[model samples]
Target chain A: MTSSVTASLPRPSPFHLLLAFGSGGLLTLMVDFNGLVGLYATPFYSSWVAHGTGIVAALAFLALLRLRPEAGAGGAKPAAPLWAYLGGVSGALTVILTSTAVNSPLALSGTLALGLAGQVVFSLAADRWGLLGMPVRIPLLRDFAALALIAAGSVIIIFGRGA
Target chain B: MIEAILIATLAGVLVSLSRQINGRLAVSTTPLVASFWNHVVGFAVLTAIGLVIGALWPAGAFSAPWYAYLGGTIGVIFVASGSWLIARIGAINTAMLVIGGQMVFGVALDLVRGAEGHVLASALGVALIIAGAALTQRRR
Candidate 1:
């Protein structure tokens, strides 16, 4: 059992950074596409596209995880209390459900800001608890700050379109 | 144009932060979970803001479509999977593949819709995005 657990954990690979950047780029595209669709169509259509894509992607992730248990286990376990999960789920539901009720641009902006805040909080908690996995490493403070700037930039871009 | 830029910038930051956080958390947690968590948090924060803004400046806030909200769930999953892929591939390689895929997909979508903007402009934007990704990627 112990061996299996260890085997299921992720192993350090040289390709990690590449994977991060590639995935990040793809994610950015997905968000942008969804926002554009939302502007042109009903907010409902945007949700459909985003959710539809997510389902497909999630399935793929599951398949990969099943195929390579070791890779899945590479990171530290979440140190967040159960409430964190609840908070996250509730927050997600609120944003999604309210999208149609709110202005598209403002809604998008709010979502981005909220999402960043959530991640930051979670990261801090994880770091404090030392719950992150073995193979993963949090960015330095400077890197984290840079990331925040990038996120801010994306929000500005979205709003700038006059959508 | 501004919306796209904002979304791009925010997405970039979120992606970077998520990766960093994921690295610290166990690898088993998966990008899906991380993305999910971020979305959850994001949703909560945005909702609060929306409520506040609605109260203060009603004109700025408008009704959203139900479908758009559903997109958040989908986004969460994509982010998670994409992040995991990042760990498997190097940032540059992954960025290349994703950007290429996004371009193909985005162009198809735009063509179907008869969207504005010249092909050249779109291409240029894609190139810039790729370059930005390359800049942010970690060196071995």
Candidate 2:
């Protein structure tokens, strides 16, 4: 994780960046969709266990990565404000909410569509305001129009009958 | 039903915020470090929530498949990648791409599971979203 924070940061090729982003998206999908189905199959109704297991896996990976001489050699700065650390809390809530939503009559795809719409709206605001210490990038009219279309699409996907 | 859907929507907002926060942290530290703090805080919060509910460990959760237990690991990957991408690309672009990816893979999974979907409506929705993403991508 810290490997990318170096002085001589090499620009990743477009292909690599796309691949990375694509993998991130797919992994997120699996975590949400599979995690829900898998956790519900268990006798224990605790969704925390799912998140706990991921922590275990991630810690192991971090431990292994740290063994590499270059892992933290970049000497990158430490963390930002304490509020930044709360990202995980938001994430935990997402897992719990997703678990409940998936089990509800709204079903998986519908729930996912709603989530996507929410993300689009939220991302617009975050980018516009530079929330959470992110770089500010205001959305233009085209961007707003595009987001509206996406929101409309999501509404149709979630509410349109079988057709 | 509507309430659950609302929760899911709210979850999306939280999810986006989490990714942005994690990504901002990653700019200073490694993505792993960013993800580490996230999982630790998340796990602690979940534990606290569970304790309040009087059941931190669900009964018979051990019976779950070895794979089900791997959600956290997959989650790590997602967070790490999102954290890495949000800085390079703007938040909206990153969100668009990630959601695009999710929609594509999600539809495939739904078809495999024989889940009842809106079909034509979903297709239109997907099309519009993709187009929207493309338009938004042009800004940054």
Candidate 3:
């Protein structure tokens, strides 16, 4: 679980950075829509519906990518280990756990903030050790500095919500 | 309180773990393919649970505004992009940048919806977030 952090730092390309950031925007939208579903039904029902739709959407996207201008989903690739295919189980479990926590005294704001902390901590270790087959990256002083600023801003936004 | 905190935190952990695992699959297959598997597998599991619990058709779920159902479509792209980004940028950068984006965009969404909040705090928070993102984009 613990591996020595890498020594050197490599900058992310501009394109990759944009994609990552843009995807975050997509997340906000996803959460908003999914939460609406939850409000109408149970969170479990909400998640189940989303996943059901997601499967159909994924198929559409895969077809588009395969047919279009420059997408490359072709070429035979190695068969994924069984464990690699279990990401959805992790995702499904998240919905249940989060639903329960949100119903608790922690509420949405607290749950969001704590979830942020968990994500940050886990990713730090993930980058440090290259957990789950990612490239190892040792966060440097600059990285910590950036994190501090983002964390502060996030805390303010989260706790400062709704009047 | 403690239980809530732990569960909330664990939920976050699972979010990252799911991405990491999907990313690994993406390494072998394309990110889109990984995302497909993610949705299909997740749908299957949820279906089983829904069957067992018999709560699949809970009241009012169907009447949710049409737009709500679109979240699943958006999620396919979101999960695919996360898988792609994690393998390319490493997890920390991906997480930081994505969270920053979500926060910034969330505030924007709130503003457009005319949601109430402390304006000064919102501005300050946004400023800090942009600055943090700039720091992230700094040349290594």
lDDT (Cα atoms) of all candidates against the true structure: 0.44, 0.69, 0.86
True contacts kept of each: 0.14, 0.63, 0.81
What is the per-residue lDDT of model 1 for residues B45-108, given as tens digits with 9 covering 90 to 100?
Answer: 5446546644222321224444534444556555565556544532323333444344434544
- Best model per TM-score: 3
Index of the highest-DockQ prediction: 3
| Residue A9's lDDT in candidate 2 | 27
What is the CA-based DockQ of model 2? 0.51
- Model 3, range A1-74, lDDT digits (tens) per residue? 13333334565677776887799899999999999998998889999999999988887877876632124335
Higher-TM-score candidate among 2 and 3? 3
lDDT score at residue A2, model 1, on the 0-100 scale: 53
For each candidate in turn, the TM-score is 0.42, 0.77, 0.93
Sort every candidate by lDDT, greatest first: 3, 2, 1
DockQ of each: 0.14, 0.51, 0.71
Question: Top lDDT: which candidate number?
Answer: 3
Q: Write the per-residue lDDT of candidate 1 for residues A47-143, one digit (tens) a residue.
A: 4345444545555665666633234444455453334233233323432444532444545545544444444454443433443232332344433
C-alpha root-mean-square deviation, candidate 1: 10.4
